[model samples]
Target chain A: MIKIYILSIFLFTGFFVNSQNLKPEIKYLQIINNQNNKFIINDNIRNAEICADSLFYRIDTYNNDVSSFFLLLSESYYLLKKYDLALFTLLQQRILFYSDSINIYSKKLLNQCLNKTNKKLPASFSILEKSLDTILFVNSAQKVDFLFSITFFINSKNTKHKLLNLITFYEKYFNQNVSFGMAKWKLLNTAGINLKTQTKYLLINDFNNPLSDYDNQDLLYNLPIKLKNKILNHNT
Target chain B: MFFIGLLLFFASEMFSQDVDFYIKNQNDNFDFQKMPKEMSFDEYNILSQSFRMQDMMFGFFVPGYVHFKANDKKTGYALVTLSSLSYATFAYQLVWSKNNLSDSSFFYNLNNLSSLSSDLKTNTLIMGGALFTIGSSYLFDIIHGKYRLQKKQNAIRYKYSLKASLSDAYIPNKYSNIACFFSMKIYF
Candidate 1:
C-alpha cells in the first residue's frame, strides 16, 4: 500500500511538472522580440519586416502578454516605413489595452510615429491622444504642463484645437516671448489650409470649428491672429 | 377564401330561381309593382344564408370555453380573447380617465372602435395588443429555457474540494471549476 501510494505521488508530480514546463506551443513571441530588438538598435528595416509579417500572421490567436508584443511589432512596422500597418497595429493595441496602465507606452510610440510623419494625422489618433495627454499631464509641473497643454490643444478635435490655440497665443504674449507651440500652431494652420485647397470636399462638420460655449472672444481672436501673422511672415 | 367561395356558391343556387322568375315576368310585360314587397322563400333563404356564413367565418376562432389542458391552438385562442377583453376595457378606462392627460389619445382611439366610425382602428388595436402579449409570453418561455440549460451546464462543471479543519477533520466544499480545455479549430 505504501509503495502504491509513492507511485501515485510520483505520477502526479511528473504530470504537474510536464504541464508547467510546456512552452507556449506556438512560440512566435521570442522570435519576434529578438528580431525587433535587433531592428530597434540597428534600424534594420528588412529584419523588422520579416518579424512584423510573422507577428501579423498570428495576431488572431495572440492573447497572452499582448501589450509588449504589439508595441514592439508596431515600432518594428513603423521602422520599415509600413505606416498603414503600424497605424493598424497601434489602433488594435489601443482597443485591446485601452484600460491597461501600460497603454501610456503605446500612446508614446504612436505620438513618436505621428511626429515623424509631416502631414495631417489620422483623426482617430488626434482625438484619442488628446484625451490621453490631458489625463497624463493634468497634474505635472508647470513647464511640463505647458508643453503637454500645447501638444494636447494642437492635437485636440479641431474646435477644441482652435480654443487651445487662442488660450496659448495670449499666454505666450503675457509670458513675454514666442514659443515652440506658436510655431507648431502655425504649422497646423498651414496644413489645415493646404488640406482645404487640395480637397474640394469637406466633411459637413469640419472638426476645426471653435467651441460652441466660448465666453471669451479675446481668447478666440488670438488664434487666427497668430496664424495670420505667421502666414504674413512666410510671404514676406 | 375557400369558405367565402363555398358560401357564394350556395347563395347563388338559392337566389337563382327568384331572380329568373322576376326577369321572366318583366320580359313578358307584366307589372311587377303590384306584387308584395315580401321576399320569396328562395330569396329569403339566400339572404339568411349569408349571416350564417359571416358567423362561421368570424366567430369560430373566438373561444366558447377555457380548457386548461386543452390543445395548444384552443388554449392560444382562449388566452387571446380573454386578454383582448381585459386590454380593451383597460384602454377604454385610460382614454376616459379624468385624472391623467397622458396617453389620452392612445386610449381614446382604442376605445372609439365600438363607435362605428372607428371600427377598423378599434379592431386593429385589440388584435395588436393580444398578439403582443402572446409573443411576450413565448419569448419569456424561450429565455427561461436557456437559463435552465445554463444552470444544468454549471452543475455539470462543479467540483468538490477538501479543506482541513483545526479539529483534525476535513470538510468537503463544492465550487465551479474554472479551467477551460483549449482547442484550435481551422476551417478549410
Candidate 2:
C-alpha cells in the first residue's frame, strides 16, 4: 500500500510538472494570437505591443522559436519610428534564424533603416548577390516585390550599373512569363518610371549628353501607355 | 434544449484552446521570409505628405493658371498685333492728312487748319490710347508668365535637411551647469 501511494504521488507530480510546462506555452500562444489580431485586424499597434510584451515576458529565452516574436516586436518598433531598437531586434532575429531567406530580409530591413538614418548604403552587395538566384527561382509575388525594392533603392542612389543589371533581370523575367497580367503591368510600369527617372537624371547631369545606349525612345514612350491601356482594359 | 446548450457552451469555454490552435495553425502557414520589408510608417507618411504638398503647390492651381495664361498669351498677342496695326494705320492717316492740309492749295484756300488740327488731335489720342492699352497688357502678360514660371521652379525645387546637435552649458562660479542635451531637427 505504501509503494502504491508513492507511485501515485510520483505520477501526480509528473502530471503537475507537465501541466505547468504546458501552461506557459499555452499562455504565450494566446498572447501571440491577441497580438496578431490587434496588429492585423484592428491595426492597433499599442495594444499589440502590450500583448507582445506579455508574450516576451512569458517566453523562455533559452529555448524557443523567438524569431517570429522578435519580428513582431521589431515591426512594431519600426512602425513607432524606434528604428535603432528595430535594427537591434532584427540583428537578434538574424542570430536566431540564420537561414538565407531570413538573412536577405534582415539585410533588406537593415538597408531601410540605414536609408532612413541617412547613412550610406553598405558597400558590399554580397548578401543580395547570393540571394538573387534563390529569389529568381521562387515563384511568388515576393519575386516582383524584391526586384522592385532593389530597383527603387538603386534608382534613389543613382547606381547605374546595378540598375541596369536589375533591368536585365526584369527583361528575362518578362520573357519567361509571357502572359500579360497585372504583375507584368506593374513590372512594366516600374521599369518605365525608372527609365524616365534615369533620363531626367542624365539630362540634369549632362545637358549635351549623347544618346543613351539603353534609350529606345519608342519603347520608353509607348511601353508605359501600353501598360496603362492594358490595366484600364483589364479593369473595365 | 436551451439549458443543455448553455451548459455545453460553458463547458467548452472552460476547456477552450482556440487561441492556441489558431496560433499553431498560423505558425504552420506563416512565412516570415516572404514578408515585405517596407519603409516605416513615419517615413512613408512624411514622404506622402511632401508629395501632397508638392501637388498642392505645383499640380493643381499652378498648372491651371499656366495653361490659362498660355491661352491668354495667344489671345493677348493677337489683340496687341491687331491694335498696333490699327494704331499705325490711324497715325499714318493723320500724318498724311496733316501734311496735305499744310501743303495742299485746296486746304490753304479753304483755310480749315483748326478743323484739320482737331481731327489730327483726335486721331493721335486714339492711337496713344490703343498703344498704351496694348503695351500695358502685353507687359502685364510677360510679368505674369515670369512670375508663374518662377513659382513653378520654386515648387519643383524641394529641399530636405536633417540636423543633430549635442551641447552642454556651464556657468562656472555663477550657476550650476546645465545637463547635456541632444536634439535632432528635420526640415523640408
Candidate 3:
C-alpha cells in the first residue's frame, strides 16, 4: 500500500531520472593518517580558526612539519564554507613553489575546493590517488636518499644499488612517489625507524626471532641467511 | 598506478640484477623452470574467480571484503576500521548536526522528497566521504593482493620445484623437450 503511493508520487512529480551520477560534494576533505585511519576532526570554527592562528605562530608548528598547517588551514576553510579560501591556500603548496613537495592531501583538497567553487582544474591538480609525477627527474642527491630508504625495504647486501634499481622501476612502472604519503620526509623517518628496530631485534635474538614482526617488508624470507651468517661467525 | 607498492616489493621488483636487464629480462623470469607453481584453481580462487567481475565489484561494497578473501587480514582490518569510522561520522554528524536538515526521508520519505540531498551542498560532509573510503580500500586491495598472491605463487613454485629436482618424477628427460609434470617444452 505504501509502496504504491510512493511509486505514484514518483511517477507524477517528475522524479523519473535518477540523479546518482553527480560527483560527491562532501564539503571537507578527510584527515587520513598513515594508518589509513580518519581521525575525527572537530569542525568547530573556533578550533579551526585557532589552528590558522597557530600556524603563523611557528615557522615549525604542528609537529614541525609546516606543510601540514596548510592542510589544516585549508580544511578549516572548507568546513567554514569558505571554499575559495580553501582553494587558494592549497594551490600555493601544490603548484606555485613547492612542486617538489610530496604533500598530496593538499592537492586532493585543491581538487575538492576547485569543484566546490565551480572553477577550472589547475595544472597542479592531478588525481591524488597515486601520481608520483615528478619522480622521473630525480636528482643525484635524492638518489642517495634511496639508500637509507632501501634499507627499510630489503635485507640484502648491496641495498644501495637495489634501491636505485627500484627507483628506476618506480619511474618505469609506477611513475609516482615511493610512499603514497602526504607529509614530507615522514616515510623516510618511519621506514628508517622500523628498519632500526628490526636490526636491533635480529642482533639480540641470536637470529632466532623473525624480522617480519617488526613490520620490515619480506624480511621473514631473508632471515635464514642472516641466521646462518650469525651462526658461522659466532666465536666460542 | 592510477595510484602504489611498499618495501617488501623490492624483492619482486628489483631483485633480479641491473635495471636494464630487469626490464629486458622480464621475459626470462617467465621461464617455466623458474615459474611459480601452477596454483590450483581452488588454491587461488581469488585470482581464478576474478573473471567474475560481479564478485569483485560486490567485494567493494563490503569494504575490505576482497582483502579478507586475499588473506591480508592486517590490511583487511585496517579497511574495515576505516569504513566503520567513515560511516560513524554520519552518526556523529546526526547527533551534532549543524543544521536541522536531516536526510532520513531521502530514502524512506521519498513521496514528500523532490530532490537528492546527497549532493555537494548537503550539510553532511560524511555522505561524500562514505564512498571514498570503500572505493579506495577496494582499489588498494586489488593492487596489494595481486603482489601478495604473486609472491605466494612464487614461493610455492620454488618449494615444489626444489622437491621435484630430487624426486625425478617431475623432471624433464633430456631426450624429450617436454617436462613430464609441467608438460612444457624448454626453448634453450
Cα lDDT tens digits for candidate 2, A1-236: 99999899879867554334323333333343455533232233333334333433332232233455555556555665656555545544443223454455567776776666564422223464455444335543334333333333333333333334434544554444222222332334454445553434332112122233332332234345665455345444
> Model 1 off-target regions past 4 Å?
A1-30, A36-69, A95-99, A120-127, A130-199, A202-236, B1-188
- lDDT accuracy of residue B58 in candidate 3: 47
**lDDT (tens digit, per residue) of candidate 2 on B1-188:** 99999767655654554313224435533533221122244323333221112222232212232323333346445545655675576567556656754544332423443555665545555545655654554444455644644443332222111000110122122222332233333446
Per-residue lDDT tens digits for candidate 3, residues B1-188, read 42245434443444433323223535743544333233344344443322223334445567676566666689888988987787776565555543456536323433333453554235344544555665676777667765665654454444334434533244455456453533656557
Model 2 gets an lDDT of 0.41
Candidate 3 regions exceeding 4 Å error are: A1-236, B1-51, B91-99, B102-123, B166-170, B173-188
Colliding pairs, model 1: none
Each candidate's fnat, listed in order, reads 0.00, 0.00, 0.00
- How would you encode candidate 1's per-residue C-alpha lDDT over B1-188 as one tens digit per residue? 99999779766755544422233434533533221122244322232221123222222244321121112245445555665675566566454443443333544556565653454464446555755664554443334433433433332222001001211222222231222222333446
- Screening candidate 3 with a backbone cut-off below 3 angstroms (N, C-alpha, C), the clashing residue pairs are A25-B120, A130-B3, A132-A176, A132-A177, B37-B157
Query: Looking at model 3, how many pairs of residues clash?
Result: 5
Docking class of 2: incorrect
Worst 10 residues of 2 chain B by lDDT: B159-168
Question: Which candidate tops TM-score?
Answer: 3
For model 1, what is the error of residue B91's alpha carbon versus the real structure, in angstroms, after optimal superposition?
Answer: 99
Query: Whose lDDT is higher: candidate 2's or candidate 3's?
Result: 3
